[model samples]
Target: MVADFDTIDININVGPQHPSTHGVFRMVLTVDGELVRDLDAVVGYLHRGAEKLLENQDYRQGIGIQDRTEYLAQFPAEQSYVMAAEKLGGFVVPERAEYVRVICVELNRIASHFMFMGAYGTDVGVFGTSFIYGFRERERVYRFFEELTGERMMYSYFRVGGLAWEVMDGFEEKARALLQELKRGINDINGLLTRNEIFIARTRHVGEISAERAIEYGLSGPVLRSTGVRWDVRKDEPYSVYDRFDFDVPVGEFGDCYDRYMVRLEEMRQAVRIVEQALDQMPKSGPIMPEKMPRMLRLPAGEVYVPVESARGEYGVYLVSRGGNHPWRCRVKSPCFTNLQALREMTVGEYVADSVVILGSIDLVLSEVDR
Candidate 1:
């Protein structure tokens, strides 16, 4: 016998400002008592017309805008933008510069996953403890970034030819220390939420989607991996010096919320491994950029798409240059936007409370979503 839900169904608006939505995101939920019957993910409140803005800026300056899109993992974003520009200009990055870029990007990936751990812990009610522990490791990484890039956040340190400048002296030693500290931090966070009965009960078997469905929906990063797909842009497509590193790609089974959490945790450890290898192999000294680059980079007419593995997922930039100083069109394929498409499927039939945890499990940065 089918119970008529129409009599009890009610619509509730859940964001544009709700703390749990993670950003200025909103969703209108049609609920049958405590369960979500349907959901409409409302986006664009945070949109700043990122692609259009990129079209206007010169190639060198587009990186600043890219950082704002995925504020959590700026290095990968910068890498995609610069690599696209480099592809268009026929530029070759030096071997030493490639090694430094890899180390910078891998460290950035770990910091980004730390953010996911802290924020997701709050979604599961472990709040302050996870936030503090996560930030402790993230701060250490950021301090190292500040030493190299001169800014804590939106450091536009990557260039079309290579990097802004050579990395700081004693970079190898500092990198080794960062890895050791991060490993300890990871274990601490693991102890806090990985085995907690409350967290496990709330997250396990919740927000599950199969590997086939995840691929159908264009999911990537830990979200896709949680479904047991071992696809990682770094491994499959090998950007920068990723091909040289020896690290494992973490995948999950069941694609549940718990799997997503666990996958990200394991991925952090792998990122640390990659960073250690990079530091060891990196040449002690070399030019960060190619010799005597142009004051104003003017590119020949061409179009190129450069894809990089960001902490979020596949961060790609498609560049079209028509014999101009600025790109004729610059399009960014943001992972958050692609993954958010599955929100309705994940939320339906789940309790209203579980919806928040599921959203957090996706680990979004909304600026990227609405970009």
Candidate 2:
């Protein structure tokens, strides 16, 4: 009844700039009818040689470029770069600054996840409704960031020792109000998609990666956790003042597209908890930077890597200092790149259209992946 396996196999190229591939990404698919037999992802179209650029600039000047790599969650990228430099320079951030950084980063995490939710829904054919809901909350958060750092999206607010600037009065009140609004917005999203029959049918069993295989592939963030691994860089590594906060890492059991979606959904609630705790515990008075800061920060010769729990996964920075104002070398271990490696593995047995849905579940930022 069925044709010979070789007779139906056909090769198709997806995209290096199409919308569904999520940003300047290409994939070569070997398919038999609609079923994908193989997949090869091509990344780097968004590459701008970010690591080489960082090596050429002064430590302070590199923050702007770090933003370009992860436009959605620039605060964490800034944090990773600055924290690495701080370790080399022996700098201490003020108590207030640490609290501020955590709050801002968590808010940015919420924003990034919103971007994923919107995009993922579209991939599943919900079209503009989910995207509209997602951007509504994101725009609200972006407005707050604009007031705080003077940039809505690409904020270089984190500095080598602390924050770029201090918060204005009434900051706590404003953040609390935002938190309340976020709770309602998340509830609306859950009601719309969590139990939707079509959504479940399309995603429940698609793109499964076993826990062992996920770990073998070196995956992190929701993609890895969707396989039931309870690893989180924040809880396990406890960088910055994350240890002071009480939060739970959400894990998934199915290792499927639906589980990945649910994991990030629950993670948003955890982020809200972290932000609330930070506001309650943050000190009111302290200098953000160390006393009498030097005009130019020169680091001692050394190498250090700082790993932070970014919205996507373990976004890490490796810095090599040469006792100069500029770093000898800088490398970003982007979670998108590591996670994207598992794409072919996830898509091999799925339908071609489902391949797009699986890619959306990974929530990649191509600039970071290609960098």
Candidate 3:
């Protein structure tokens, strides 16, 4: 038996300025009542020609450009660029520098996850509590960053073979205290949001994707982890001092928005553990940068690619050197750009409101996408 119902056509432009879009992103949607029939994500409102401009700048100056490409995860952006140059120039980073790199990068990863948790919660009507809580904790971490690097957000602290500056006195103690505070704060936030019936109702079982589909669509980070894959560049392909650190890669049972959220939470805990270990074993005195790194770096004529685990996913840098101070070509493999591809699949049959919620769960920064 079938019941006849009236059908109505509706078309809407969700945003070029919606908060849930995470930036100036527009989505065209065709709907029948509350259900979305079709949607198209319109991007490129934030493009800044970063990759094209890198070819004209020296290796050292080009890092500032990478900072703009993924503003949220600036350390990893600089790391990827420097790693590419290190591989091409055959420079060996000192052991101390490697550990410092790992520590800084992991801390930034925790900060980035906090942002996702906060912003995603707001997008789904959980109010601004999560955002407020997240930023409160994020500020402590950023203070540590400012103490060490002299910049709050875009820190150009990572150089060719080492850091631009050493960790200040009392930095280890501050890091230790912050890690403890973060552990406690994470527990509080988890209890507040992870088990809430309303929160689960909004996120659980939504935007489901299998591990196969995630890989096919080039998804990474929590999006891939949500699909039950334990693949992480830090664990599988060791970089910096990641091989020496003890940590776990959190994987989810189902590929849903809730699972992604949980994976990121667990990952933040793991990052805290790694940071504690680095603090315990940190070298007290050493040169932050390599002794022999040339002021004007010139690489052998060749191309090399270096992949690093950023907060979002595996960010890779492709560099072509023509035996000059400037690179002949540069290309950044931004995770947000590829991760956004799965959005259509995630939102196709869901309600209009769920579209924004699912998009936030994926956590794509427009700068990274537009780069």
State the lDDT of candidate 2 residue by residue for 1-371, as single tens digits.
25655566899999986899888999999998888999999987888999999999999899998999999888899999999999888898888999999999999999899888888889998888889998898888998899898888788888889988889678999999999998888887888788989889889999999999999989999999999999999999998899999999999998999999999999999999999999999997888887777878889999999998899998999999888899999999999899999999999989999999999999999999988
- Candidate 2: 10-residue stretch with minimal lDDT: 1-10
**Better candidate by lDDT, 2 or 3:** 2
Candidate with more favorable, higher TM-score: 2 or 3: 2
Measured on C-alpha atoms, candidate 2 has an lDDT of 0.91
In angstroms, give how far residue 227 of model 3 lies from its true place. 0.4
Clashing pairs in 1: none
TM-score order of candidates, best first? 2, 1, 3
User: How many clashing pairs in candidate 2?
Assistant: 0
CA-lDDT, candidates in order: 0.91, 0.91, 0.88
TM-scores across all candidates? 0.98, 0.98, 0.97
Order the numbered candidates by lDDT, best leading: 2, 1, 3
Query: What ranges in model 2 sit over 4 Å off?
Result: 1-6
Clash-forming residue pairs, model 2: none
Off by over 4 Å in 1: 1-6
RMSD score of candidate 2 (Å): 1.2
